[model samples]
Target: MPKGQEGRGIIDACLQALGEVGAVGGWDSSSPDGVRLDGARLGVSVTGPVDPATGRLFTPPNTDSNLAGLDLGADLARSTGLDVRVDRDTNVAALGEHAFGAARGVANFVYMTVSTGVGGAVMLDGRLLRGVDGVAGEIGHISVDRVGPSCGCGRRGCLEAIASGPAIARRAGDLAEEGGPLHEILASGRALTGKDVDECAAAGDIAARLVLESAARAVASACVDMANAFNPELIVIGGGVAIAHPQWISRACECVAREALVPANRAGIVVPAQLGDDVSLVGAAFL
Candidate 1:
């Protein structure tokens, strides 16, 4: 899978999988339209927002323009000759959780992922909230600090800029420069990760604790806001950073309880995702 050929790569993989399953016949790889996977449906979970009406992706923050305005569902449908459905990765993940994970049987809930980047999906009254443009639930861009660091979305102090995995590493790196346990790890010439920060904090490293605490506060603030806005029954936290650190989830739950509106706090409870990495995979099937 080479750069600039991701679309082709996905189609090839789909075709190969269909062929292996006896759902498609022999086809020329070069001619994607040579054959069809009749009656088969494909679901694509993408990294950015997608217009449900047109099935085209919006210009994602800090991403290649090629993805912007691209009708991925149409392209994949044409290439693989299968019914293709597409939506933001987080949105599908919410569906997955609602159908089989922590949010199961919950009618109103929020799903947030704190992995490579922070993202969220809102399910209200048992339905996904696709805004007028079909790109709602972009809580990552919510500004926690108006004067804080710049985000890839060209905003100042976005939650993603402060609490994403990369953000956690960046925060740790800043402390590392001042000579701390994080610095000792950096001295080993190994790049830092969110997991590293979690481990360091678990070991009682002051710098790591400070960094993680700051990130947790930011996340909690966002959760409080979401609780007030949606009054969800649960706020399901997922992704690498959250799963790696149960303390982070606990901290957010505490914050939400302490800071959110009385009714919202009483109604909303933050919890961990149960499906692990298979959340999106299972969700896509539901789509």
Candidate 2:
């Protein structure tokens, strides 16, 4: 396990989970020091300010925040007893794909995930891009609308707040309650999940479709901005919501081509991603 922000709780949970799973010679960095294995000494490295109120290091929960992953990694290495390897989660995803998946031979590409949140990573000449402090490719926090909903990172109108799976479900649930049959169906379920919303949309439920369209539009708008900025040859989009609705991939590409700079629009581009739920796990294992 690699610890960044949310380290303490994640570390505790991972320790319990690992024990339950019979993991041996485990590695974890759920602390500010460095990495820790079972019964090991601590290493020290510089990270960032530990939040006085929370007693936890203040790392960026999303791109909108000023903190960076390098700081987190250094802190973990210093405080724990394991060798810590760190990079943005999205960057790791891109590396995983380029090393073994759809982008194996590609030299320029971007990887994006659109589930509870939206995230992105970039590859150039088959190498992952890690910005200063290893915080490159954080697309979720990109400000799309100046006055849109407030993001988790205390920002307004980020791509994440508008297009992530949870965002879609929230919007859909709100719309469904306005006398739609889909709303009634979702209401009867144990919980209103993003999967349910996508299924309903696929089944021609008006409310569900509306919600999906809203999210898709926001995602498309963000993709357009990214396309213009990076102009990569391919954009691989993964995550639960996107995998459930492949049409969203096409729609996003269309929106980008229609809205991005002329040169970027002219570049041959496509949207796709291979690994699904296992992406994060695989990347974690690599770390």
Candidate 3:
């Protein structure tokens, strides 16, 4: 959600993309701040693990603590001067898949995003499951290891703690000083990104290879657990990490097929999300 040369937020990007596509008017959505824009017919802002009932992000994880009590949804509706619908990003992405992407004909599926953070949305029997607090499908917080690194959600060994982009990048940067190949890779003095790990692994950097492989295995294990629990027909993967490394889906599929229960194993489908980056926006529109 960083701004561009002209201080463009996701809304600005959406506006430009809409213009290029000759959209008469369109809705904008993201998990960040409100912004100025022109030509948008409606605006949708999906912010936080917030309460839809109160539009408040009370003690939200992975967001500014100051946003804890803000009425993000109502605020956006005011600034945009058009109706603004708010929901969790994961749910929106799941809706996008159901309405316009890979799960077109399917009735049950899980939409997971593996980028800065890991999250998921679940649809069962043709309905999105919004739990009591609209916080269903919070797969990122599912603890995978009891003693692994701590997560932003204040938990240890959560899937996102060990397998997310930042998590992978943080581990790579920490091990960069271990000597040999990684030393040179960290010469830039900043940090190694998840993509950097992939590139270095491709060039035979042992540390990078290990980090990527470990992340892949973590992803596979987590997906296997989900397959067993949800018994969904499909798990559509998206987000920066999945797009950057298409192999994740295949690796996860291999693991799920081998590890999940007989019926669940046969039913699960792991595939890349079809709407790509647009799933969030498309899903918000449905909201």
Question: How many clashes show up per model?
Answer: 0, 15, 0
In candidate 2, stretches whose alpha carbon ends up further than 4 angstroms from where it belongs are 1-9, 13-57, 60-81, 185-191, 202-204, 262-268, 284-287
> How big is the RMSD of model 3?
5.3
Q: Tell me how far the alpha carbon of residue 233 in candidate 2 is from the true structure, in angstroms, after superposition.
A: 1.7
Error of 3 at 174 (Å): 1.7
lDDT of 2 by residue, 138-207 (tens): 7888988789778877888888887887777776777775556567766577557787787877877787
**TM-score of the candidate numbered 1?**
0.87
lDDT of 3 by residue, 1-287 (tens): 22222212344554444344443434343324333343344424353475655455566576555555555545544454445556678888888899999888789888888888898889999898888987888888888788878888888988888788889988877766455566676775757778777777788877788778877878888888888888889888888887788888888888888888853436337888889877877877777
Number of colliding residue pairs in model 3: 0
Each candidate: RMSD? 3.2, 6.3, 5.3
- Rank all candidate structures by their TM-score, best first, as comma-separated numbers: 1, 3, 2
Best by lDDT: 1
Candidate 1 RMSD computed on C-alpha atoms after optimal superposition onto the true structure: 3.2
- Model 3: runs farther than 4 Å from truth? 1-47, 79-81, 262-268
Cα lDDT, all candidates: 0.81, 0.64, 0.72
Instruction: lDDT winner between 2 and 3, please give it.
Output: 3
Q: How well does model 1 score by local distance difference test?
A: 0.81
